[model samples]
Target chain A: MNLLKEVFMKYGYFPGCSQTGSAKEYDISLRKVIEKLGVSFDEIEDWSCCGATSAHVTNHKLSTALAMRNIMLAEQQGMENIIAPCAACYNRLIMSQFEIANHSGIRKETEELLSASFQKDVKVFNVLELFLNIGIDKIIENRKRELNDLKVACYYGCLLVRPSGLTKFDDAEQPESMEKIAEATGAKTIDWNYKVECCGAAHSIARRDIVVDLSKKILDDAKYHGANVMIVACPMCHTNLDMRQRVMKRTYPEHEDFPVLYITELIGLALGMDEKELGIDLHFIDFNYKDLVPENSGVG
Target chain B: MSVNTLKETNKLLASFVPPASFTDEEQEPLNTSVQLHRHNIADEISERTFQDVSLCYQCGKCSSGCPVRYYMDIAPNKVVRLIQLGFYEEALKSSTPWLCAGCQTCSARCPKEFDLAKFMDAVREIAIEKGIEVKEKNILKFHKAFLDQIKSHGRSYEAGLVAEYKMKTLDLLQDVDSAPGMYLKGKLAILPHNIKDRKGVKSIFKKTSGK
Candidate 1:
């Protein structure tokens, strides 16, 4: 915990909705590792939804207002940078920041709606962006253990890449940041066709069949590509792929069970934390760590 | 024109059709590419739409990544390019925007990073503005059915979405014969209701739509 305070002293955090509910493993493990690294996540006061896909669909003005509300809070809290772990939330928040900053009329209008004036004071970061910015050398220096022998596929869904100018952390068509993080953990990263394909975000709720089909394709391709585990940095993507695996198996009998993990969880496992501590127990898909991990590894 | 004398009508019609060049006694000569300007709809363009279209780079990435591109009359990329060129009426008439599933894939994969999905959405927005109804029957039925389901349940229920989708696209019900057996096996559920945030959902809809 002392180490986390040191690392997170300057970090302001935003967990978004999915991180609280479905992908809580990301929260648990992320906190665990960052705590060890002395990073503190001073959450903003009275944060609201980043207006995911719904607000954007209904009205552009409302979507900008929704994102501006949280950014205003972050700015008021005196934190210029906030880490939004979920890709969808990050995309929405950053995209809104870019829009609100560039357009004077939009900034004026949204500020009026929120009953507050706006300035371009706050910026959003996806978790990978923070990791990259903090420098991989720092993380590598802190590695207590290695995760050698795990064949991992780094899956980045829609939000991370779309509207590339806003979330300019990596290339949209071919992102290598996740793979770099995986390699830093000493895991073998696999290349696959559907790496950036949609896992059907909110479509999972309104369109289950489509989500199932999309997930089945993702899981099957990952397995066929020889990946033992799929790693995600998005909570919504993790929830749809992990929590809905049973439904997917039932819908498509050919799909075999495969574990979906948050990148933080893998980092925890590599750091020699117990499987249960990383929240791997919450996962629906069964995995045998002994076979996937090196014999000397401490994923107990 | 009588059917027996249809050849004369065909010849007359052929004369009306412009050749490589046309000469008129009173009209001025038009330049090459003038045909394109004749069909342009700049005056009918919506300024709000232009704001969205100006972001487009004519990147074919949206077309390449689109899932329903095969079924679309205009590819998603072409639709945005068309909008940028001020072919507003032609773009509105195209089936591309109406066919989008709001997947975010095109918006996700765009190299120039244009929100083709949002532009497609703006097409719907402008369509409603112009009071031009959705001409595609399947898409219309889909909107109606999903709205009916949400109107009933306050949130979209999966079973309801599926049932509505199936009803709207009659071919889906035929697949239903094989579906219920899977449903019986716990793969599907008949009743659909909001799982959580029940009242909050109604408030959300109301707040956004002014319902």
Candidate 2:
């Protein structure tokens, strides 16, 4: 752990559509946390969507080309590592690198499409993965404020842990990386089975019943396990858990609308970040965790 | 998944079939050509998804771990089995691949390290390519709508995505309750975010999709 000393690493941040739209709070909190930690990042200029479910499901070639464009852009910026806050984009971007590197035919196809050759130069990491590399102890030591007695259920959803060949990170079967990161902020993490469960993403609009059925179960488990706040990394997961509570409640009328915070937002709060700076007020459900933790109180 | 779960897998698969419902076409047609056809489909799968279908040994681990199994017409493991059995038409027609959430649970849980997610994704792709009608109309609409947004602006435009999706599915009032909350929370933008590489995105789709 001696190499854990604070070191400057620059990453090209590729914010998915949700980060600018549904999960803007994620972007805001990410900015605050990274700033507080003295971490520097550059937004990959002219970055495009990673073709999350659409390209992959419809046309495999289209999917690889779209991700290849973003990776090439990051490389063009002289950056070797790129990070995405959205799980869907992160999966696609990383998978794009993997696809173009291993599959010569697909790589040639993509290279022809973009009229640009893809070198196995850039690597993609989710923001959570980036922080885990930064060391959880360093994060804890950097905390300006501690969330004492705040019970949180850390939800990884999917994409962060699967298709192990591409993601190449986290235990696919039972992942505790996010839980460990959340606990570093001085919050209590509830152990739960649905940590890596699917929240029926992208189906939020078309097949909402799926999202309702799936997200409701995740929320119910988190609540049942005494979690007052839910922490997530993917913007899609955040939307299903935070924005779609009203829709989910149609099936379960008694379902309480719980606040879902991004990993960065939780880290920012633990760092004593200004509420507005973290964009905490923009949640669909009221963030009512202040009462759970005594104001300005030290670790209980 | 394992030999230990064979009893449970059989019981589950049995629940779906009516007792003694095997009709005149119900012969266990494992002929020589059928065997060739089976290997042909397996070869096609390997070429498409880069997954060795031979690695699978009828283990139902994929179906057991699938979160959306309750809604699938055939379970995740069964789709691979159907392909391995040369039932390409049956696998393509089934609602299983379309219903897949792409959660990668099946891929993660496969004991043989078979890429079930990619296999299912490839099935959906083949289904579309062959003009097989998807039983899940709304999901198809959603994917088409999502791709449409990406194709035009080189990024997703939420307002445009919703408008186009609603137009395609004709479920205008569907999930309308979440809109007000989403808009009020600043979760949606009225305009699409454009990437300067719009031509690059369009060409990528045009070249790869063969459209």
Candidate 3:
């Protein structure tokens, strides 16, 4: 029927650690939206954490093994393309694939360690890239209700842009696909300095003081630029901005909370899905969605 | 080494960052797009990771506790500084990456939230790809043994890991004293444990394979 529908689309989706536990909104909304696009996502069963920052540091083989294990699972499922919503997850996954592929001996070694040889053929796409592949025109055509002049800021954090070779999606310094996707859904996008800045990711757990300061800058920049919502593709960024705001307020006592929405939730809303269906209420930073919802809604 | 010598070495290492042009002919150019695209490795550091590096202020916080700094020909802080200065060649070549213990002490204490360990790992990946000979053989041997454990178990098994490691290094007899300690401390067992997610792990391995 549609390009998205006609493609017989099927892919493996690696939700990473944050999406499974913390960013429940992104995990729920992403599945629903992709389903709406007539795509089927087969999540790799028993996927382990991608080792994030710590594994790579402590041990190279371990870090690569962490990522390589996931890739191996995806390949076994015969799904060549994977949609990874987390930026860090995407970068590490893609980086591991390339590193293993270029080094034959390492690949052999990894094969021995994991009990499987990776094909290195799998492609990992972040949410934006997946949506781009699904065609913005199709999403726009599918939209029944237009976003009501909602001013949103697209936050890339760092993983999505840098290590551009791994992402191969957008500019490292300032990525606009998230913004473009927002615009395609009929919403206004804002230009902010903190677009590609760090969100003090893992530091949120071990070092709150630093994350608080970094989050303050990002939230303050978004609010200062007159953005009503900050749209992000990273679960960690969402957690820091959306969930960690209370801590930030307690620590700083000066900053106010700004709602952070995953890109999929915004797209689902703009595509006429219900708010509850997108798990909007799960966010820590409260936003009055009634004000944002139109007179008639599909997602009640 | 004494505290004073450590500090003296730290100072010498601090100047190692902003690495001078490659002194060795064996050193390969670190940042080429073809290599980056061919392998899909990020050619440049992410500004976020870089911002963490910028926080160092060249304080040597990471260098002081680094266990291998004494043995290392380069300093950990200087490695961070070098990457900060975009002298990736020297940074990648330095033995710092393989030396990381994966302890988050430096990452935890980083005044700027910089992850020196993660940066080293990234550089290590690049180095391995360039086939730049590692300064030491144990790192390479360890990598091989670790992977071998995974291949047999569909996940890592500590006993399998140690055994394969000992075999690959051809030094099974060398760590004999640790054998009694490993068994006594419940660190090693006569048999390896079966991996929990064999099928799933197998599937994961299949997808990321190059061919």
Candidate 4:
């Protein structure tokens, strides 16, 4: 707890585009959970898009330049550390930092395009990394009640850990960081196969069938492993897994309803925060907190 | 040796010889068919992305782990093979690059540490630059609409992106059921959040587009 307090006194927050619109619950829950944990963050001023999958799919330079602009903003604001809640934004910001520091061609082109000096000074951390730095014991000590009734499958998804050379946080293949944090809240974290599987990502809008097919497999794997709720770290993963269940039910009528909650939302629930306060009520899949908490747990 | 064993050995060796009709002239025509006109696409991709397609040994680990490979017209390993063989047109025309979600599962599992996801990005970029017809037109339209939203507001506007994408691809009816639910949850902000430095973002678009 002392280490957690010392390390994350204040930092920059990059709440990627989805947090404001599609995944508002993620933002809401993250804020409430982090506030309870005594972590503070200042949003980078006037930050633009991190040039997500769309930017990199069509143009390489634009992707690097757009991410660099946010890094520049953080550096100018004197933030030594920045946390990107979205896995895609964190990946792009870290990738851009790596490219600017190592690749001279990208560095020069990005500097020229943004007309700003590239200072690879600010370090980037994903939401999971932030929790890990905050220490699992600290999380356990802060929790007001144990999640005894919750069977959780911690889904890391793709961008958070893959292409290990860039993000370089956890084991890309078999990540246990989410499970470690999840177990600290006293939930039964299941050992699942589709933890790092792709949820069809941005294709949720363009190609609904593919997203439905892939997300269905993930949901089915979680259910088979006895996980009643799927926990995710990325907004994209949440959208594909949580919001696309309707399409999944239509495609496979026998598909059962499974709740998907952000890791922060799960922590908030264990911390005695109500579902409405953590924005868990906003999820597309219905989740009643009373089903999990016991009568004497003191959480209404 | 026994006489029966010697006869068996001779019979087996006899089957190893080529038929009398298979002449050296016939083999020469096979060589002509192998004389394919190869392009320098591998070098071009290497130059842009700093990834060498020649490093791929076609282990098929990338294709096996890919979640969306079933939907791709060409498998990921086959796409790399096409690039290595300098079949730029075939590689560019493949739906594999467009359908790739940049999941990086292939890149993470590759024995040779080939960045196949970045390679897919480079292929998509080069294909768009060369004005090749996009095989996944709706996917391309979605990407374009997403970028246009950023260009206008400096951040993504979900409602505007959906409206623009539907207008472009005429995919209006799909996902319409989810809209009212999203609106009810306050997930869809009707107005865009314009950044203070809109001019800076627009300049980035202009400069990156090489205007």
lDDT of 3 by residue, A186-243 (tens): 8899888888767766544434455677788888998889898889988878867876
Q: In model 2, what are the clashing residue pairs, if there are any?
A: none
Instruction: Tell me the TM-score of each prediction against the true structure.
Output: 0.71, 0.89, 0.63, 0.91
Q: Mind giving the per-residue lDDT tens digits that candidate 3 earns over B125-169?
A: 667656666765566566555445544554344456557666766
- Which tens-of-lDDT digit does each residue in B1-211 have in candidate 1? 2222433433454455443333333324333323332432322233433333445567687788775566578888777666555445557767666656566777766665556676676676655445454556555555545444443554334466567777666746434443454354333445653324334333434554566
DockQ for each of the predicted structures, in order?
Answer: 0.12, 0.64, 0.06, 0.67
Instruction: Please write out the lDDT profile of model 4 over residues A1-300, one tens digit for every residue.
Output: 868656666779999999998889889988888888888889999989999999999999999999999999998888889999999999998888888888898888888887789664899999999998877887888989888788899999999997787767789989888998999998889998999999999898888999999999999999999998889999999999998999888999999889999999999988889889888888899897688667887754
Report the C-alpha displacement of residue A93, candidate 1, in angstroms.
0.8
| Top TM-score model | 4
Candidate 1 chain A, poorest ten consecutive residues by summed lDDT? A202-211
Off by over 4 Å in 4: A1-7, A293-300, B1-39
Global Cα RMSD, each model:
10.2, 6.1, 14.2, 9.0
Instruction: Give the total clashing residue pairs for model 1.
Output: 14
How much lDDT does candidate 4 score?
Answer: 0.86
| Candidate 4 per-residue C-alpha lDDT over B123-195 given as tens digits, one digit per residue, 9 for 90 to 100 | 9998887777788999999999999999999999999999999999987798889998999999999899999
Please provide, for model 2 over B1-211, each residue's C-alpha lDDT reduced to its tens digit, 9 standing for 90 to 100: 3332433443454455433423225634433234222234556666787766656888798898888899889877888887765556678879898888889888887778888888887888877866777889889999999999998998898889999999997889975777777788777888889988788888877787765
Order of quality (TM-score): 4, 2, 1, 3
- Give a tens-digit lDDT track for model 1, residues A149-224: 6889899987887666566778877989999988887789999988888776665543556667777888889998
Give chain A TM for each model in order.
0.92, 0.94, 0.92, 0.95
Model 1 per-residue lDDT at A259: 87
- lDDT string for model 2 (A97-165, tens) is 887778899888887888887654887889778898767987888988778677989898888877776
State which candidate has the highest DockQ: 4
